[model samples]
Target: MALPGRSVMPTLGWRWLLIFSSIPSFLLLLFYSMVPESPRYLCMRGQTSEAMDILEKMARVNRVALLPGILVSDKRIELDENSDPSEAAHLINVGDGRSTVVSELESKTGAIMALIKLLSPEMIRPTILLWLAFFGNAFSYYGIVLLTSELSRGSSKCASYPILKHSVGSSLYKDVFISSFAEVPGLLLSATIVDRLGRKFSMSAMLLVSCGFLLPLIVGQKEVVTTVLLFGARVCISGSFVVIYVYAPEVSTRFLV
Candidate 1:
C-alpha cells in the first residue's frame, strides 16, 4: 500500500513519500492525546477520587451515568503488599478462592522449568522441528520480500526493458508497488480459504503452487510469460505467508510463549 503511492509519486518526479507518510503518524498522535490515563494507575497511587472522576467522565462520554454509591469509601479496607499482584492490580477476584504468589523470580523460574521440560528427548524432536521450520520460513520470506525489487532488477532474465524505459519502469519501487497491490487478492483469498481448509493443508497447497510458478522462472521462459508467472508466484507466496502468521500463534505451545 505504501509502495504503490510512493512509487507513483516518484514517477511523477516528486520525492514526497516521506512527507505523505507523516499523515498517519500525525493522526495517531492526535487520537492518542484525547485518551485518558489508565484508572488502575491512578488507584495504585491512592488517588481514588481522581480515579472515580475519570470513570465518571468515561461513563458520560459513553452517554451513561455512574450509579449512586458505586464509589463508596471503605475505611476498613486493608492493603496487603503480599497479596497476589494480579489481584492487587485489578482490586477484584473472579477465581477459585485461592491466592498464589507470582513474583518476578517465580515467573522466571517457571519459564526456565518449562524450557527444561521441553528439552526431554520425547519433546525435543518436535520442538526442534517447529523452531527450524519457523526460522527457515521467516528468514527466506523476509529476505525475498525485502529484496524482491533488487532481485528483479539485477537479474538480467526478469528485468522488463520496456517498463524500465518508462517512468513506472523496472525498479524496486515499481515492483514493490505491484506486489503490494497484488497482496489485496492474496489477503482476501487467505481469509476465505484458511478456515475452510486446515492450516497445514492450506499452507502446503499454497507453497506447492508457489513452487510450481517459481520453477518456470528457473527453467527459463519468454519475458512476458516469466513476468506473469512471477506475479502469480508472489500472490501464492503472500497468501501462504499471511496464513502462516495466523497458524503459528494458534499452534504454539505454552513453552513457546
Candidate 2:
C-alpha cells in the first residue's frame, strides 16, 4: 500500500505524497485508541481495583483462570525500603560497581547532575562517539525517507525507468504509502538478523553494504544502474537504521538505558 503510493506519485510528478502519508498517521491514531493502560501502571498509581480488572481481562484473553486471592491488598505493597545499602550490597558489586556508584551519585546530586558528571574527561569521549553514531544514523535514515521520491526520480540505464517521468502531483500520497510498506520487510529482516549476528557487526555490515550500493550512482551514468543501486541503498540503509535503534539502547550503561 505504501509502496504503490511512493512509486506512483514520483513517477507521475505529483507533489501530494505529503498529504497521502497521513493515511498511516490516521491509522496509528485509531490503533492507539484501542489499547488499554497497562495493569502495572494502574497498580502503581494506587488503582488496585482497576488493575485487578485489567488483569482479569488479560487472563481471560489468554484463556487462563485468575487464582483465588491473586490480587490481594498485601501484594500491592511498594518496596520503598529495598534501596537500602545493606539490601543492595551484594548486587552492587555484581557488575563493575558502576551502577552502584551512579546510583549513589544520583541520590546525592540528582539525575541531571549525575549526567553532567558523565560528560567529564573520563566519560566524554565515549559519550560523544555514541551520540555521533546515533545522530549520523538518524540523519541518514530520515534523509532518505523525506527524499524518497526525489531519490527515485530521474533517469536510469533502462530506456525509461519506472520513475523517470513521474510527476510529484496526485501520486504523492500513494508514493508515501508504497515507500512505507517497503520498509516493513527491511525492519523484519533487521529484527531477525540483529540477535543472530550481534548488533555492531550487523549494523556496520549493513551500512557498508548500503554505501557500496550507493557508490555506483556517484560514478555511473546509466539510469538503470543508478535506479537499481539507489533502491538497494535505501533498503540497506533502512535495515541498518532499524538495527541501530535496537542495538544502541541495549549497549548503553544501565543508567543511560
Model 2, 98: alpha-carbon shift in Å?
Answer: 33
lDDT at position 114, candidate 2: 61
TM-score of each: 0.54, 0.55
lDDT of 1 by residue, 36-122 (tens): 877666565556788798999988977886777755433222348764333335343324434334444566798898788677676
lDDT of each: 0.62, 0.63
Model 2, span 1-257: residue lDDT tens: 46675566455543454455556778788789678777765554457788898888888987888888855433233335554323333322324678767768767787676678568676687678668878877886776566555544443343333444544443334444565665666777788888889988888887888778756544434435544555566677778888877776665563344
Question: How many backbone collisions does model 2 have?
Answer: 32
**Top of the candidates by TM-score:** 2
